[model samples]
Target: MKILELIRPAYLEVRRIGNNIRRSIEYSLSAKKKDIKIAISTVLGYSEQTIPKLINDLKKYGFSGNSIYVFEGGHNKIEHSFAGYHYYKIDHNSFDLNGLITINELNLNADYWLLLHDTVTIGKKFKKMVYTCQFKNFLGLKLLKKDVSMNIGFYSMPLIRQNSEYLHSFKNTDYTEKGLLNAKERGAIEEDYIFKNSQNIGYVHYDLQYRVKCENDVMYKGRLRRMEYYPQLDMTKYKANFVTDKEWIIKL
Candidate 1:
């Protein structure tokens, strides 16, 4: 088991390389040209150290400066700033129901907005295709049963700058849910409220792995094994690839 553990990272690296190559080829062959601008935004509450890494990874994937917007939530103020990116600090006490407040505050001027969480890492081809695709309302990934009421961490929302009233309405009420379960309920309710009224929603499935903290309070070397809900669905149709550095021993 120890030997297998030592070999996992190398194995995952090889798999990631292969996946990247395949995705790159597919993207090159099928990518369509579009005259649209995309702005990426993320709401950060606690992961200050992880935010820079996320930004750097996005830059590595060819995202231009100032194209990404970071909205700081909670009491933590980001000390580091990157050029060509916009940053806004929202008071921790603000009425944010699963980042709605942060999302509402942004002046999303692009044709599309890619909403992300700090933990998610975007692939190069995925980023390119997302911008090039003509879908007006794209859900980057489907929510699991446990997340049925909430929106996935990554989603693409059509940006309509002229329709400011709809966005401003999110700030009208505060989320009353207290704990984690209730918070998720709040998210589901809010997302349903926002998405149910919209037309033509599409889904693009992709792999999204989680990074867990070790007992030492540091991020583990590999991906964390995702937990299973009551009845698991066969997600094979999504063609999502998952690779973690560690074994499937640790539970998230």
Candidate 2:
């Protein structure tokens, strides 16, 4: 077992290299810059106050305001916060429910949908990260969870074409049923494990939020493991290594 453990990373690395080559070939033959359209969506319920600033930051960080969608399920709905931003209202005021609702009702035409939350913030070159990712078909994080059992939530991004399949799979039978998030994320975890998307640059709730308290925290290794050699990732501390890099998120 010890020897196998020692050999696993090496084996995974070799396999990753092979997969990268295949992905590169596929990307070269199939992908074009103009063909990729990513729609950024976020749910606002408790954090309505932060929506305006978040919008400003997104535009300031290089995302066109028109490509961003804000779903409001809060006490107040502020429409057209940004010039081209799209605002929609939900029937209920719950992030999990509202988010899922947005998924079910996504009418816009885009190749992919990026689901973000209030806690996670993006900075310069963030859109480039999304555009550069090589996933052909997936609706979860780019790849990997700390454990197979970990649930994927708002941070999970799905391909628009395949949304009807996985996104709608975990819908609660009864509207009044509880633990909608648990149901949804558990479904995502199961689906992602079955799919096992190849190396693509993306982040989720954990990659940036699961931080280290002690110097020896495994997230240090986890962050190091998830990364690819990209200058943009290295240029910004906001990319990953939340724990290893001592950039822990303070939840509001």
Candidate 3:
């Protein structure tokens, strides 16, 4: 069974991270078992000119499969636009049930969906750890209690072996509920409610470094120019040793 990872990215007031996208795809290909077909799903709303460049870079990394998808909608706007040419619009909020519906439509026969975000990059050892964890959970050897959030980190981390059983359980389930988050909080953020509900259900790892960049955000580029190169993946700190780059790995 081949796995097809989804790459749906939601952006609002962030600069285009073309380098991040490049590194992400590279890391995905590197982490695969040489048999899985990795695909990317992205939403419209980044810098208009950067989309084509990002796609061109992906092609260079051999993203020629039939699993690449795009979605429409902005930070809070739902109306479609030409800027959304590369993506499609769906009914729902970000990181909510609509995301699953989009994935199900794209790779209907895929054994798993490895969701990637616009800013997520997989370290050298990420694939090994995720695959092992996912296998155990899928086979009933482990139980993953998590909240399905509307963040890049949650969606892009790569879901493994997301079969029909999992989908059936995930559908119609309003992971985001009113009681979970305050009315003001929910209105302020798009997918806050979903993230709250998905907590502890999956192997949820919070890598703070992968957060979206701000206009004045200051971060070291590390050894890898792309976001895929997670050199700072400290095992002692993050509880996972997903990097082997000596120069970039911080001694925790």
Model 2: residues with Cα > 4 Å off, grouped in runs: 1-45, 74-83, 93-97, 136-252
Error of 1 at 68 (Å): 1.0
C-alpha RMSD for every candidate: 10.9, 10.3, 16.3
Candidate 2, 134-181: lDDT as tens digits: 444334443234433122222323443344555455434332334434
Tens digit per residue, CA lDDT, model 1, 43-65: 34344644676677767877666
How close to the true structure is residue 46 of candidate 2, measured as C-alpha lDDT? 37
Tell me the whole-model lDDT of each prediction, alpha carbons only.
0.42, 0.43, 0.34
Candidate No. with top TM-score = 1
Clashes of each: 4, 2, 19
What candidate 3 gets wrong by more than 4 Å, as runs, is 1-43, 47-50, 74-87, 91-98, 105-107, 119-252
**Residue 106 of model 1: what lDDT?**
51
RMSD of model 3, in Å? 16.3
| Model 3: worst 10 consecutive residues (lDDT sum) | 232-241
Q: Please write out the lDDT profile of model 3 over residues 1-252, one tens digit for every residue.
A: 122222223232132375445446545654344333233333344324233544444445445435344443223333333442235454433322334445554543344444433333343444433333322232111111242223322232234233434443433322234321332133234333333434333333222233322223223222222222322221111111123222222210
Please report the TM-score between candidate 1 and the true structure.
0.50
